[model samples]
Target: MQVDVAILIIIYAYVTTLVVLWFLMKVRPKFPSGISIGIVVFLGIATTMAVVTILEFAIAPVGRPASRVISIARGLKIAAIEETMKLIVAALGILIAKNEAKWVDTKLSLAFVSGFTFGITEALFYVARNSYSLFGLVNLFLSRLIHPVFTVSLVGGILLFRYGKRIEGVLVASYSYLGHALLDHYLTACACYISSAVILLALASFAGAVYLLMPKIEAERKQRGEFEKEATVELKDHWLNKM
Candidate 1:
């Protein structure tokens, strides 16, 4: 019982701290007013819950006592459902708020928050419904941590779309889904007493995902910086004219 409490506390603390930091440093200043930002945050959380519920129902048809091939297919299906829902939610959020101008600044941050919420919520749900030993708990924690990286690919797709590369954007976005499916495949393989070297493939895939995501983040950050500079100049001009 004590162990479970400690695990819960650790998970909560980690999640809360990351969220608070993102909100304060990344999200808060990007919006025009508190109310708008609140709406975005609320929608993100709601989207996470919706995704989790949908995934549970969607995967139920996969059933149990599966062969290795069937297990891998299930994993791919899970990845497809999750990544699709996330991408759709993020895209909808962008379209609904895209006219704000500030919406572009929040794109990456919002995606991160949504993905973070999804991963943590899904992890907690898994913890609640299953028993885990110490090693298993550690593995679960590590696995959940990587889950958010998939959103980085979504952001890349969004960026490309905004830049008028629709087809390329879609293919780039699907990268996350494929990466996620690969990780799930290896994990399922390991569970079935397959050679553990497959874990290396998972790690490599994660590293590759991160590598692919970095340039997109850098591009977004540079663009946001430019936007802030322009806004600052405009505000100064307005004050000077008023004077």
Candidate 2:
């Protein structure tokens, strides 16, 4: 049953990734290169492995204990580790891209992919460790979907930092970390009363980040189209001269 649960979540993640890619490609004229997307996905998986390793060794492992405080602490630790890893990997992905300006055009999508992959990887780990019913695993998968928001927030923050808005960058990044910690803490502690509030807040943040990125994405798309037009014109002139 647990194995079935894991398979189901994995299938869902795969389909979700493809759908997102298709949607972005349809709506945007410019997208990140395949290599850049590949790197981000690889980094996302590596980030998950790093987190699991640290949790298993460096951090005090949290078992199925009855203590709420311990559970909260575990959650905080998880947030700290996972957020740090996501930030690092996201930045690394940007750095690895050959054309930073081109990457900026589809930064949000790349960030989403990274976070989505990371979240799914983490969820699979939990699925392996625990025996969950089909419904329970589905719920877990849904909750894990919030992860892309955190990554998008972090990437936006990093962009702000690079563009000289250091304070705002820090604040935005802090917001992502805070939302992630709260969700994890409440979920792990089984504080049902507050979970709904936390989830709503996280969703709101996700919506805001996407809203903020949309204008920038459109602007970049226009700019890229103009650049392509100019390039085609130049190529045509060169061909005429050759003829």
Candidate 3:
């Protein structure tokens, strides 16, 4: 149960991000229901692990040392599993947000918060199982970032889909999946493919996408505000008339 500095940093990052998300959700006006947050968290963990495990077992022959054919097959399997998990998580997050309507903003925030929680928990498990070295800690830090980043991207897509652009949401989700898969592939080959240029490019792409979508997100917030005001008036009227 030895804890490395990198692991400590990752845990701190995850917790700090989550606390900020919580504060934002609370101070920003409206937020999702308790039930909705629970559902998103549950699906995030269940869907990702289920898909990863299934792909691992299905491609066992490919992962075997003796068969080059099997090795190639396993690689493809791993890629597919990773990409699919990203896409599914993103899509599901958006879908949940859509269902919650006015709570889309809070739901999106919670989705990423939940994702960070899952990533940190999984990293702890991985470090516990493996050797706890500086390298292992760095690996955990990078791996932990994966979940939050992917989730954030997915939440962005979901917000777009809820507003007026379903296609944009799908595109964002797809990009997140591909981006995650590429990052994972690169990291898996870090020993040989330690190219800072490539890593920076990928990070830039993700950051750029998020930046581009900020305005739309702000617009959505305004819309949610209007919806909340209308709902409050309606509720007040209904109760007054009943009284």
Top model number, TM-score: 2
Per-residue lDDT over 1-243 for candidate 1, one digit per residue giving the tens place of the 0 to 100 score? 355334433432354344435434533424334443455456656766776676562211112333443355676787787776666655555555665534444665455555665666676677777777786666455545444456645675656666676775676566667656654664433332221233233334333433444565457668778999999999999999999
Candidate 3 residue-wise lDDT at 110: 62
lDDT of 2 by residue, 203-241 (tens): 555455445555666777678789999999999999999
- Number of clashing residue pairs in every model? 0, 0, 1
The positional error of residue 169 in candidate 1, measured at the CA in angstroms, is 4.9
Can you tell me which runs of candidate 1 are displaced by over 4 Å? 1-70, 99-105, 133-138, 161-171, 191-243
Q: Which ten residues in a row have the lowest lDDT in candidate 1?
A: 57-66
Q: Tell me the deviation in Å of residue 60 in model 2.
A: 19
**Sort order, TM-score high to low:** 2, 3, 1
Give candidate 3's whole-model lDDT.
Answer: 0.52
lDDT agreement with native, every candidate: 0.54, 0.64, 0.52
Which residue pairs in candidate 2 have backbone atoms (N, alpha carbon, C) closer than 3 angstroms, thus clashing? none
Task: Judging by TM-score, tell me the better candidate of 2 and 3.
Answer: 2
RMSD of each predicted structure: 7.4, 6.1, 7.1
